[model samples]
Target: MDGTSSPGLARSLFLLLVVLLSSSVAFIEPCDLLYDQAVQAFYKGDYGGVVRSMEGALHSYAQVRRSKVGCRLRCEDQHPFDDDDAAAAAVAELRFFDVVLRRSACMNGCIEDKLGTQSMHRVSEDVVQDFHRRIPYNYLQLAYQKLKQPDKAAAAAHTYFQANPEHVEMGQNLEQYKDLQGVQEDHFVDREARPHQHSFSAGVRLYDQGDYEGAIVLFEEALEEYYKADVECRALCQGPQRFEGHNHLLYRYSLHELISVFRCTSLGFLENLVKRERCLSRKRWGCPSQTASEASGMDMFGRPFHLHGRLCREAGGFVVKAAWYLRRHKQELELLLIGSATMGVEFSEGQYWSSTGGREDSNRIPSGTDGWMEYVPISEKKNVSVMSPPQLREGGPLVYDSVRLVQNSIALNGTQRVLLDAVISEEECSDLKHLAHTVTMAGDGYRGKMSPHTPNERFEGATVLKTLQYGYEGRVPLRSARLFYDVSERARRIIESYFLLNSTLHFSYTHLVCRTAITGQQDHRNDLSHPIHADNCLLDPEANECWKEPPAYTYRDYSALLYLNGDFEGGEFIFTEMDAKTVTASVKPKCGRMVGFSSGGENPHGVKAVTGGQRCAVALWFTLNPLFRELERLQADEVIQALDSQAQSQWDHGLHINPKDEL
Candidate 1:
């Protein structure tokens, strides 16, 4: 009986021990749980998740302190220790906080690597401020360096060295930072001097408005400033001081602008000349005919002779009468004379010369007589202008105009081939605009115009509204991905149908751009007007001579634009022919409108300025490579899984959470 009872008692005790251990594990401190989650997230390459977990950990630590002090030990909280156990707990909490801070420092770096350096600014303000306060300044220094903010990086480095004067690497880092600061200051001075930012801005404004002459004047002034700055830079480089790299960007920029202006001016002149010639030819027969004469006397072949000629046009042919003289006993005597000369004209009815015999050879002229010549005007072929297609009638759910062939040939073959229409519904347009607004609110507004000093001067005032770019393996915000998929799918279908391409061709990464109007009294330099350019060329304006080889596996063969909102002024999509003077098409943005074309030299295009209100559009680029299909498929699946998980979480928590709130 004792043996049986002991076996049952042993089983009961084992079960009780297991239950107690489970409870203890479940009741672990919230901070510890959060920190563990953060570590797991970091290992999974989920930097955003890591940041969220760390934030929760910090909050949990705060709650623990509050509960320990009964919410009334503000002064004692500084020491936060009533006994050895309490002191140890307090020390452990501080160590945890330090670990959290260190992990958060890597957040921006990971984000930059996955997205781009420009995306670092999208990090939360709270996270950034906390990092600045708690982490070493080196992280901030590295971030600012990546951002190209040298001054800020230098300041951070300076603060770091001051804090750790005896640090092993402090001397080396401090020296490097000082040198960087000096270089930055030099560049700042040079930037201020050359192109005189204000003057350059004014020049760009004039150029955009078609005021070529005014633009030329301002550009020249900017050019002068560049020259002076360059001279000073050279002198500085020759001294005994440490040699910082010279910046010739402004000089190069000014030269490029001058060249572009000159080219545009010459093209404008040629276009005007062609138009004037066309007009003159229309009234050629009605114009009055005029006669002119000239005389000269000179020694030729050791003989003195006098010559006289009269020139006139008759029946679309030039006629000349001439007389020549020879000296006889110091007296000038006429030796050769010609009259009623009609040049290169067939003898037809009343148009024949009366005095001149038909087919007279040159030998028939008297010795020393002046020689008469005639010129027959060659008939020029008349150019018949190709009529433009009739404009589409307004007020319709959908309207479109197929580009008409010009001069009975394929119209703007290549990149210029475009179909314009309101393709999507107003609902989609409204939804996209709302999504863009939400994205803007979640981050520091849009990244303003970048590297305005690029060769493409038109980019100076161009502000990107909300841009989202991702590789096939990278994750994109759910809303942005949805918008991208919908617009690109529709655009791909349309392009395939129009071009009769195989449906197997798929699209690659896309770029979404939004532009707003220039406000206040600033010159329209910042207005978004993409200069005429091929989509597949070297992006740097300074590297105009660089030619990118066509991709082997994939090519940006086709480009499409979907306009989300059209209630804007001045922004028109303009396509120019190879000559740059002829506009193949000028499309106005309309809500739900889509315009697509080839993306090579065959279709150079640009945007006009956005004068009022705002403009938003999604640009989708397509490729023909088959390898990208698998990548795109995997990405789509990942997006689906992410969406499902998010939905499940929201439902489980019984909370109406915005997907972007996670971002």
Candidate 2:
């Protein structure tokens, strides 16, 4: 009987302990757990997760506050509260509301920073309320404006101004919104079908199809349409408002696209010239019929010419006597011959003579030349039907010779720096620009000053835009990524061979950056130039500077910049030797040129203000420590495979790869 009683006592004691533990665990409310999750998500840069978790917390808290039963079950406060239960509940509600508002503000900022205004609108609409509105309305106003909903933006701005009547900036913003609302309405009503827009779109399609000549014509048409639009706007609109009414933004964008198309077309022609020259050199086509000319000329209309030239191939130089027959239209034929004769022989080593109103020395040619001499036609438009004397041609190879890599030492004190010319091919340079432009179009233009909260004073008057990085998470565009990786690898090899840098050192990242000049506006004044600084530094926000003290580990040991285009003004890379108190060297941005140097105290450099056009470049940073080795190893194969897959997909889709809708 005593043993049975002991067993029952033990069972009851164990059951009591279990119930106590369960009650303690139940005291931890769902809202608290949700808030913790939201905080974690915010730190991880997962704005969407932050929004979801915060919304859940808000809903849970609201449910607990609305129902007494729910409050009793969930709100098991660990701290003791006196008889003033109503005040405690009020305090708790206010605290929870405060947390939600702060989280929502952060989420709104994230959306605005990354996804632009449309996303900001979606996120703002969810959080903004009449009772709890303060900062959210400001974001709502801006978001609506970007969405082209002027009326809604105006309404948001008005509400914000009414809430904070004494706020000077808010009042100013309200007035601006009101003014823009009228302009926006007028634009919507007055805007008509623009011919240029149609032409531009058609041209882009033709370009995608590789019909460059057709694309050029359409682009020209688009430019003419823009001019017509401007003229019409000037005639119709009042003084100072003529330019304001027309689509100037579209006009500027069209110009940019036209430039890109022209570049592509020019590159295509150059490539074809190289290919034809290569075939000729290889004797792919049987030795030129011993005919006067190696290759015959065709007119713009694709009509073959009765043109011939004597081939005088030489080791160092060659001289050819090119002759053409004039038909009924002698004037046109002579003019065409004069213009096109030099096109093939312009790159020759020695000067050649043309028979268009030029005296030929008797010593250079025999006394009685031949039937070719009798064919020389006079400048008059009459039809003589005579064949002209052969034009003397002396020039180097028809195609561009291989670029020789040349390195020059920069005269900077205390640093070993060099500029490498012909480091990359023209094709690679063009490819990089196209990739940068694509990425810029896809993302929010370009980012400046890393953080929005950071003061712009340090940036001077420059605006910099950066594309997705490579050799990390495969964020770079597929084609551009391959080009960048190739360039980076070449740079690494150059550093190893020329500078004698350790082969073990590896590049951490490669990215494209475009820098443009800025005009002073408001309190901010920025020059296109970047301030002198070393890449390896500890960011010290207290002093508003990059502290240049050496760290224990080697990071950013070297920097490499590959200039993509040289068609810009004023921006120059300058290296300052602090010890010598002199500018060591100033390098102009040249296409396919690469510059590399130590990114330490010995080499302090800055970009001079770009006064006119924008400058684009590829920046590569390397480090001795293998901190990013595993990341690069993991991403290398994935990136290559993804790029191959993308290329195959593009091929399958045929010409005219549609612009990505995600960006």
Candidate 3:
């Protein structure tokens, strides 16, 4: 009887041990475990203990980052499953993504599934993990500050800053730490700031100081670190990277954006040198090429109520391929396109416009039309026609015997659109770059101190407006400001002549743009200097449609990016399909090299991130319509015209001015 009872008791004891282990497995958040101890030490006012626990917490985060569990959690955290069932579906498909995404999500889910019912709902594990890696230095920064150790405090602040360059407060804190009695730049070192970031930052600093060899040595080290980091980053699933999600069905993205205030797109309405460009509305808006009559009463998805007056104001800005200009008639406005007949455009509800019935005057709208209507005047109207592509050898208006316009296999088959070489000289490129750096550093860029890119980037773009503003102030050379026009004008001539538009092109916009990488920002980087986009329309990747609406510079007929300095890593100009991936063409930037293309969804393009050194370029946007002329360019032309009478030139005119001439 005793031997039988002993066997049963042993089995019960084994079962009891299994229950305890299972419960222990439910608490798998090691970062949380270490963090709880730090929190307890903080509450107890044991500052040393808090530091020690946080050190362990940071190690836990690093270990988790090296593990598949953290990588999978981060990949999914970016675009969280919008529903519980979707989350379940995602969890079930981990194996598929493990192969597709190249990260083993299956093991991560397996490790995380043990915490299913016992999971903490207060904060996401991935978010906490990120904080665990970066924010401990921030806490340590404050702790060391409280401990009266300025050197260690500065080091902590610097570490946090390296991890997050865009954090306004930490940048300020780092500035303060640097001011501390004996804290030098050397004190701003971190052991955990991604080995690549340290090497890259040092390289960039050296490069900026003209120490190219030293910078190169460091850059090579950075590259080696980059490969290691790439593997580690994959394991962490960190950054604002786009990844495959189970919510592919929720990819209903419609960018009803215009430049500012309001957005209006023309649908199949392009007049001969007198009509605004038409864009097919994107998703749920029906046919892209529907006539105004067919598109009547359609919803302008993002048009605000304040845009009632600004709709046509913004619509009038768009210039199609034909180089048409719009004008206003007395009370009645007419928008005539080459493909359409004399039809009456009636605006009923102030939402959509439709054309129907007959009107004798093809160029004028019918009497008493409502809402916003654009018309062309009789004097400005011309017999301009978009005949065909220009045969350059046949002697077009512009000749380039010395220059080479290489037709790249970019979008639109690349015959008309080209990569222009030798249009602008090397000296001209240098001056414009100098002007860009000078004017942009004067706090006159589009975003003023902040770049118009993802976090951890520094963007400096000086528009024709700012360049002229600085030139007038004598901060920039007059010749540099004029060169911006001269170079862009050369590009315009190429577009007008090559595209064979009988009418000349006009400057819609001109910008001298620069992008630089800030160290430690890679953790949040999307890896694009400029996200893939169309100059005149918003690209809808999921629907494969180009939404031409507000915020997009739809008035732009052609885009020309003239490359300046090229001693940088990355920053390649890539032409993509409407999908924004699937590279069709890539143009490496160099002095005097210009990429000319149609500014539509058909020519979606973007600049890759400038990983090292400074990248400078002149972004030139052209429009056919004189009405939508770049006002800033006109202002610059005025300033140049005052100084040099020969500068009284249109961006589309034949050359009478020297681009390399400096004031």
Model 2 / residue 521 / CA error / Å: 6.6
Off by over 4 Å in 2: 1-407, 410-414, 441-481, 518-528, 538-554, 579-581, 629-637, 641-663
TM-score of each: 0.33, 0.33, 0.40
What does candidate 2 score on TM? 0.33
Please provide, for model 1 over 1-663, each residue's C-alpha lDDT reduced to its tens digit, 9 standing for 90 to 100: 111122223223433433343322222245545655665666676655665675565555444322322211211222333344445877877766664454444433422332244232233333433333323344444545555666655555444433232222333544565556343532211111123334544555666676755654554454334333322232222212111111222332233233222222112212222222222322333323221112123343212132222111221111111011111201311111111122211111121111221112221211111111111111110111114422222111122243221211144343335555556677767866765554432112222323232222222111121222222223334455465555656667766566555445476545455665546523535533666666654333343321222211125666788788878777898877655446777778887667776555556678877666767777776766643443333344344445568679889887766899989
Q: Write the per-residue lDDT of candidate 3 for residues 287-312, one digit (tens) a residue.
A: 24533323332132211222112332
Model 1 misplacement above 4 A: 1-416, 440-484, 521-528, 538-546, 550-554, 579-581, 626-637, 641-663
- Each prediction's whole-model lDDT (CA): 0.41, 0.44, 0.54
Model 1 lDDT at residue 388 = 48
lDDT, candidate 2, at 466: 25
Give the top-scoring candidate (lDDT): 3
Among residues 3 or more apart in sequence or in different chains, the pairs in candidate 1 whose N, CA or C atoms overlap within 3 Å are: 336-369, 415-603, 416-603, 461-526
TM-score of decoy 1: 0.33
Cand. 2 Cα-lDDT: 0.44
> 2 or 3, which is superior by TM-score?
3
